[model samples]
Target: MKAIVFGSTGFIGSHTVEQLILKGHKVTAVVRSHSNVAFLQSLDVRIVEIDYSDTASIKEEIEGHEVVYNCIGSVGLRSKIDLENAVEIDLTKKLVRAASLSGANRFIQLSSIVVYDFHSSEPLDESYCIKPQYLIQQLLLKREEVVRKIGEETGITTIILRPASAIGRRDYMSFFSRLFQQHMNDQFPLLKNGETKVSLVDTRDVGRAMEWLGNYPFPKGSMNLFLLKGFDTTWKSLKEEIDYERGIEVTICDLSNIVEDPVSYTLNTFRTHRVWNDEKIRKLGFTTKYSQRESVKDAVQDFRDRERI
Candidate 1:
């Protein structure tokens, strides 16, 4: 299949492009002119630069592609200018509209599991009701709704994948990656006992899942949602993995006493034990290749290689 991956320079996007190429699919990586292409340059892909703000140009570039992977979005914990919602929703709308006009066979959207209620005691599944607690969560939910409506009306086979916190090679902005970097600098903080379980997925597995979906036989105009989780582990376990990998026992700073508005919310988010029922995709024969331990080790190695440490 001929595929075009937007935002192909970023973490998930780069991995997705790699998986697509490895699966014998011809891939065209689309990115902004100023975006870094160091990783994409290493792969056997046709890279195209375009302004995402221009729908005509997007449609022109997307014309010859059978599949359009919309991996464009902001990832991180920041509320400045409502950046998450603005970039995610606005760019998604443009991409969908262009893909519809360009006659693309399928549109794959990369969404986050954060759309589900973060504090839920039960495991989150695709059928679980979306009750986002904060500003970014609210916007992500809104983005999914927009995709559903646009897909139904435009008759595009659209798939929305809500992946857990992604970490591995090319990971920079994820929670675990930041935590690992902080740990390396001896400034990592632990919430309470650091026993809260966090659901995480490997970016490579996510890319594999996207490639599988691209070839799946779904009816045109159908909208499907799937949850992708690689493995479940606790904060303490992750920290221990880092310690063992780096060969050091670092001092843990207690954040259990901090109780305020934004600070408390951010800390409590990591503190909350979140589990995902990602069985839907797995039952369909989608298997994850990376374990929690492997993911942590790879992420650590990637960081070291990048920093030349």
Candidate 2:
């Protein structure tokens, strides 16, 4: 299979490219000229710089690629919502349109579980009602809408994957990175007595799923969505793993009452027990291979290596 991935330098995108190559597929990474390609250069994939503003140019780049994987996203906690939308929604619009025009067989979009009502009393699935409250969640919802709507009109097979909080070696900027840094400084805090269960999926597992999806046969013009979750574990357990990795006893702080960054922390952490049902994807012969503990250990080591701790 020949595939092209946008935002190939990002946390998830890099892993996707790696897994695809390991599976013996031809992969191409589409990135901007100003973006860093150092890590991408290490992989056995072709790298191309394209101007996303021109849909025709994007189409030209996308042509001859059987599958187009969109791992582009803004995971920054404090990014302005408009900027997030521009990257998440506007840029995605161009990419999907180009894929449709380029005769691509499938378009896989990377979405988040936050698009669902995390306040649900039961586990979330594809059927759960979407009630995105905050700005980031709202933009994600819009992005999904754009993909599905355009996919239907263009008669292209589109798949939307809502992955849980992704963590691993390449997690440069995300909640887990911040959490690790805070833990290293003994400033990490917990909500609900550090027993809040977080839905986590390894970035490697996410990449493997994308590789599997690339081979799965789907009817033309069909749209499918799935939730991907590796395992669910509590903050206390995760913190202990990190504590063991760093060889330091972390002083657990409780911020349940304060809720410092309510918007980001709420959804990222103990906001109404954000669990997901990924049976749909699992039934399709794709399941998580890495556990939360393994991912946490890898992340801790990666951070230490990068920071020279």
Per TM-score, the best of the predicted structures is: 1
Per-model TM-score on C-alpha atoms: 0.95, 0.94
Instruction: Give each model's whole-structure lDDT.
Output: 0.84, 0.84
User: What lDDT does model 1 reach?
Assistant: 0.84
Model 2 stretches with alpha carbons more than 4 Å out = 83-87, 259-268
Find the 10 residues in a row with the least total lDDT in model 2: 259-268
Which regions in candidate 1 have their CA more than 4 angstroms from the true location?
82-85, 262-265
Model 2: lDDT equals: 0.84
Q: Each candidate: how many clashes?
A: 0, 0
Q: What is the lDDT of residue 191 in candidate 2?
A: 75
